[model samples]
Target: MDRKGFSRRQFLQMMASSTAAAIAASAMPLTTLAQDSMSYNEAPMLADLVASGNLPPVQERIPANPRVVTPPEEIGQYGGTLRRAFKGISDRWGPTKLNEEMAIEWDIPDPDTVNVVANYISEWVQNDDATEFTFTLREGLKWSDGHPFTTVDVQFWYDWYYMGDLADRPTPITIAGEPMELEVVDELSWTVRFPAPNPLLPLAIAKLTLGSWAGPTMAAPAHYLSQYIPDLTTDQSLIDAAMEENGVDTWQQLFGDGGTPQGQIAGWWFNPDLPVINAWKSVNHPSNDPWLAERNPYYHAVDPEGNQLPYIDGMTHAWFDDNAVFDLWIAQGEIDAHIRHVASANFTFYKENEAAGDYTVLLWRAAETQAFYPNISHKDPVLREIFNDARFREALSISINRQELNDLVYEGLFEPRQASPVSGSPNYDPEFETRWTEYDPDRANALLDEMGLELVDGVRMRPDGEPLSFTILFQSALAQRGDEVNLVESYWEALGLQVNQELVERTLYQERTDNGDVDVGVWSADRNSVVMADVSRYTAEQADGPWAPLYGAWWANSPRAQEEPPADHPIREIWRLWEATLVEPDEATRNALFKEMLDIHKEHPYMIGTVGEGPVPFIKKNNVGNILGGNIWDDTLRSPGGVASVTWFFRS
Candidate 1:
């Protein structure tokens, strides 16, 4: 299965020698003076140690010129438990990842700008062609466990783990449709080279910086992870030893499983066995109820006055199964601050309960969560064929009067637009919002009939004479949008298409989408927030198969599954345009490519869209400060991007 010329055994023997050389090449010193500029103060829990001259001063524990954070009211007291909750275990890692890994991302003021800012890395130098990039890591930076994190760690993650070890997992290769090369420049620097120019390289690094995941900028410590890697350890017996200790299946499972005690992939999963650089680390990992974590003493960020960031000492997260009772919970006055998952529909109820609960609801225009977007790539074989037809999607798009839909569901507050880039994006085109959007049932009926979906006794019939009707699969988390879904179903049904709706658990819904099992899929997007990271979704060839499983499967592996598009496929140009868009060196040229792709979406209504921009609610305790007050709520600007909850403090 591994085409990389090394089986588990060969790679291990090679690592036995390579790891020997890399061991000393990897040990970075933690007592460096880069942290000398900051003042020091320990948390109240550890205040006695500082008073008694028992522990190292806070200056030595924090980064030099620690990434400064200006809270709403000066700096904050360093102790209070931030309480939060979510519905699922997979969502547990989210709070841990917030504002923790800030590195390598371009600071786009809006989606339009091309200017990039250096954050985690000290410096970055790109070649004229944009194919090669040289980077310098922050000097004297140490992991939470006092491990010296160096360029060698990055090299190990890129060359060995991402490119080599993960035989089945997907990477940039799946997106760019090309391979990449990584080289360690020095103890504190590295280089990444693509076969072709990749202007999106910074975007990739930027995403990695914002997210708490394994990335080139945030590599696993080679010295710490070597014991688990079979190649690095040079002993298969160690694998069994680890399996017996951790109760996992294999070395790969143990090492790649970053959430468990074995793998320390990110700053969020900061365990004693694992090291981190974030402001906080989990105190009780893999926890279901009241999941807890504590502040990282050696945090790389600080308040304006040099106090280490994360004004709060720790956090505790609860879990819930149903969102139907979210408003009930908010009304109960038990929630501290909630803004992530609570929908806008509950704002009225939330406002009625706000005074008693001691919370305030902050409403920001939401671009991603407002609309009903139909995935044209429905999974059922019969429905897939119909949904894939551009005419079918166009008819669905034109039949829905978004204004009426918005008026009915959101009280006419949301913008009646399409699933394209919003105002700020360099790619935003007005035509995308208007094309084929008028309410025209006659035209829709004509299009269906032209596509040979004839009207049989009032309902549209398939080519094989079966009823051309399918249930739109929806996630229960979006129960608030149930009315919107039902409304859209009526419009389609009015066009002699018997449309139905099915509500399922979020987990089950996602699983079905991933497997391409559902009929019509209901979803929405804040297109600007996701444009760079998930551009493939806009095109036919996708690494993530949920949107278009058949095309995704073909793109993921041309050898397996059903089919591939001919050279002249409607979306093949989108695929080619994406390649050029990411690779184009000039900013204007890249933007033009983005515009062209948006135009293609307009020209071919691949995904049906209804209401677009709408208000998404952000409710938090009145005392919570540093809420990043502003009008802008794009992906990177609002809670979507500004989850630096670490910088927040209680006003009291």
Candidate 2:
């Protein structure tokens, strides 16, 4: 990959950032610019074009690519609205945090999540290759006060949210560096450019910039959040020191001191009191009661005949505990459709209410992949050595029966999974499927013996005289379900491994998870796609702050080596190949890489994964056509804020 020597086509078509436009313009042929692919030489050519007077060349450009799929007949319509309700607003809105998860589920549009505002918003980089993207803003898109929504708004989002911290921009903000351009092609149009090639970028752009780890839940209105940037970004060392002096040791205290009552709502809503949510604005709500929404004239999308959307009237959300959502839906039938199903620790109620048809409990499997993490940071040298041992890992792999786990933990509601990431996703490699060891006590015992782990005084001890006892701390809330910890504890006890279980509250659980305090813990890394770049970012060895590097420190220190240098491990080589696929423009090459990654991940047990499931939504009969298969409900679509149940009336 002599990135410098390649011609434009070779550079653009090559595996990675070889065809970068900026690099090309500096040293390549001007005539070869835009040579169909973005190979190394083409980048320089394109850069030359930009550097020359021809930069930002004037033209009335239209998409030469194939048209996007039209919204389904059931989707494109006017008059109807969807009123949804939620338990509460989500937390972080940044990338690699809880807020990101919420946004993925709600704000962004991907292959999953059927209903998404991003889909309606014309994007700058609209296609797969991301060779080009453009956005034409809604004709009269405006804030509640009638200020126009323009390129500035998008630019603000990029500048404040996506510019810094690789962790800050999960999906979009692809160029790994600061934002470059926010060109206003026209009043209603704009062009944003990345420094490098990123085909996976359009989906990233649609997602919230900060805390993307948590999944898509909400988005910050750039209009309002920008107001605080100057103050927040300013040097307040004195204030921070004072806070520390005052015993506010946590970063949250400094970052989240007194501001305003609506401070928390800034990430999801522009002005909570004003109640402007996307295509509609809230009009009325009972004192200390649920809120309502009405159509907004400022909404940009229009029907072919020129009528605005949201044909149906407004809707309401009864803010309550998780169970109340289900109860209200069944009793008063307030839930036209559970746009987002809220679950709590209480499974007993869910089980009882489900059989009675209490609001149609759509017990779809969770879209998250849960796995048991074996921290290589275990202090006991002997135990650590065994964990690092391939035979032990293989033994653990075979010892645990996934079928029994599926039957036990999920109550037979989900399928068994073996892949580390999404089991059935397009990126999942079938060849990498690690089979669960049959429930053979003999084989389990034999593998342990083969590794010289022996039972002494009812506790498994390694050959070096180190006890096999280790604590597995799990979230107490989830522990209560199906007696989860007990099941695991019993299973490991049968394997002659002393498993000490500790169930802690959510806060403590989070702290331990962050500190990597527990030897083994159960968690789910539910991401959009398991690209090496995405995982590498998460597993990087030395991460600072709330986010941990995507890969745990244990896996990178392997002694195994196919290359001359042990550091040049075969696995890392495989990973690099896998990562190259993320930016590949060709679909066939990308698919091949995806397959390879999956196969390799399965073979190397980077992290053992268990299952895959859908985030289910329960809808009422009146809202029959409202639900889309992959739509993860966002707070904006919930009652009192967004289009509410009335958005359903827009059915084509």
Candidate 3:
């Protein structure tokens, strides 16, 4: 495969060098010279606060060794509010992705390679066996509220949230069926020791652990959260009073419920009082019409010129329930810089109105915009047996006219392929992408006939004399999904089968799929570029995917699991391969294991792909600087986060 006329190997090599340079630059101190020798500049708003004696000086607010961000184009002028839109309070990711201050992050200096780089943490040291990792925090890092951030926060997170009962064990820190042990080394340092080799821990941290809000081991503000923890607080009445004020019967409910003020404080998105380390801190709750986030005065990053980062003053995310309203907002140039919910079908509309909107339309690479999954572990035994058959899956695969769907729904901007790794991925293969993706009605019919299920009254009949029928369950809020599902419904309906399309609310859809109530599930096959980082779509290890929800629940040890797979099940092999990849220290060996797992998906149409590697339109206002186009859109890399929006500024 080629990218911008360069061969895959050549592109990867180029990206490696560039990624290394970016990572090196990111690790540099805030100033080019010594911290004491250099003069730091602050945003005008912060300067005003300082003049009024309301805030500390810039130098005091910033860390001793703040992370430096090299702007893409030029150093920016600070102060304009970056306007954008969100669905509602539930649209946490819209803001979270913009300011996902992970301890480490996946940096794509170029389009082809992803390198792990330090973000919240300063640097880390890993043992030869990869079982132990020592992380050091920046010397003078402070939370948004001017409280020192230290290993104490890490300890609090580990003890109260991880080891205690606040949350479940996050998969990233677990190895050999045990959670990794956390050892606080010093005020600014800590160590994480695993039972088995965990070379992929850094990658997992970058992918899964976005921030303190992501949960335990990532570290929360101990200074603030301690007030809520009953054991940590000196006064037991404080907890009782807080719970009573929040109208919660239990202390746990007051601390964990999103509706409660304390719970919202923990999330750092809904409470302005919450102290965050992100470039921006919430100024108002998301429940508000236009949720606002102001620049954190203590943001621990600077440009090469020593200007505290986040050149923009703040962010305003206007709430909207409908995608049509969002599209209108984009068309009218209400959004400054965005990529999250941009629809591929609106490519032409965006391009046509680029001049009027005062924004530039950029097409980024999406892994898989649309993929269908037939539930092999359906509630009906007969349907489950039919879906479990490889031949039956292949029929479902080949029967879909992907090209038509691409043209009709995506405006011919996406590639017609099966669900596999994107071409940019190291594990990408042509066979894996094109496997059984032919539009063949005759073949589909023949496969059903071979299984002795005859076509009766223009509909396929099951062994139990019932009509072969299934509902395609999808989230109604998802952009372009209904249109894609409609086309898929038509394609499958043409194969002498009853196809019902159900577009439910997002939460309802997730609940139905998790309970294995849906016959078919529809979602984007994201994380395609780095498939190994997340294999939910390919295997039954995550209940979110539709293919085998019960099997996934069992594998994940979720309470919702009704039954476990038998020893001879193909899914068990996938589970084995995934477990091996987790502990494999050698990169090449781990990648090979991941490839072997992908090979299984190629043989079995677990998640059937229709259109993928599509162009995702990113709308950037003309005045927005440091907005990079053509980046890979994947949840693992966290698109806008990888783009480093902290350095994004307004030209004015």
Overall lDDT per candidate, in order of appearance:
0.60, 0.42, 0.76
Deviation (Å) of 157 in candidate 1:
0.4
lDDT value, residue 334 of candidate 2: 53
Consecutive 10-residue window with the lowest summed lDDT within model 2:
58-67
For candidate 2, the C-alpha RMSD (Å) to the true structure equals 14.1
Pairs in steric clash, model 1:
12-231, 35-64, 105-206, 283-293, 368-525, 368-526
Model 1, range 1-652, lDDT digits (tens) per residue?
A: 1112223233223323321221112112122224555446567765666678865666666555355544544566667777666765445334643543645543322212223345545667778887887877666667767666688777666655556664322334334756666788789887777777866565555444412242325476677667767777877786687678766676666654522222423224433356666566667654447677777666666656666677887776777767756666676766656666677655567677778878877655453434444444454557767777888888888888788887777765566777776544444567876777788878888898899988878888987789887778877666778888888888888988887788987777766666566566776654344365446557633312244655655655532232465566666777677777877778778878876876777787665667755555666777776553222244433234433466666666
Better of 2 and 3 by lDDT: 3
Could you arrange the candidates by TM-score from highest to lowest? Answer: 3, 1, 2
Q: Write candidate 2's Cα lDDT for 1-652 as tens digits.
A: 1111223232113212211211111111111112123211112322355468553311111111101222223443444334445433321111012112221112212222222333223433344455455665434445544455555655554554445211133333444433445566776566656565556543343233222112111123455544344444464564456446546653333223221112222322322333233444544422223545555433333322222334444445545444454555654545555533333233344435543443444322233445555654444456556755656666655666667776666554444565343333335444454444345566867888888788787777878787787776656334434354566567778888888877666557655654545566665434423233244422323221111212233333311111121364444555466446656777678767766755654565644455434333344433344333332222212211112222345333
Q: Pick the candidate with the highest TM-score.
A: 3
Query: Which RMSD values do the candidates have, in order?
Result: 11.1, 14.1, 3.6
lDDT of 1: 0.60
Cα lDDT for residue 351, candidate 2: 39
Candidate 1 wrongly placed segments (more than 4 Å): 1-38, 46-55, 92-102, 106-116, 167-178, 209-218, 234-238, 241-248, 255-272, 369-381, 540-546, 556-563, 631-638
Candidate 2 lDDT score at position 369: 49
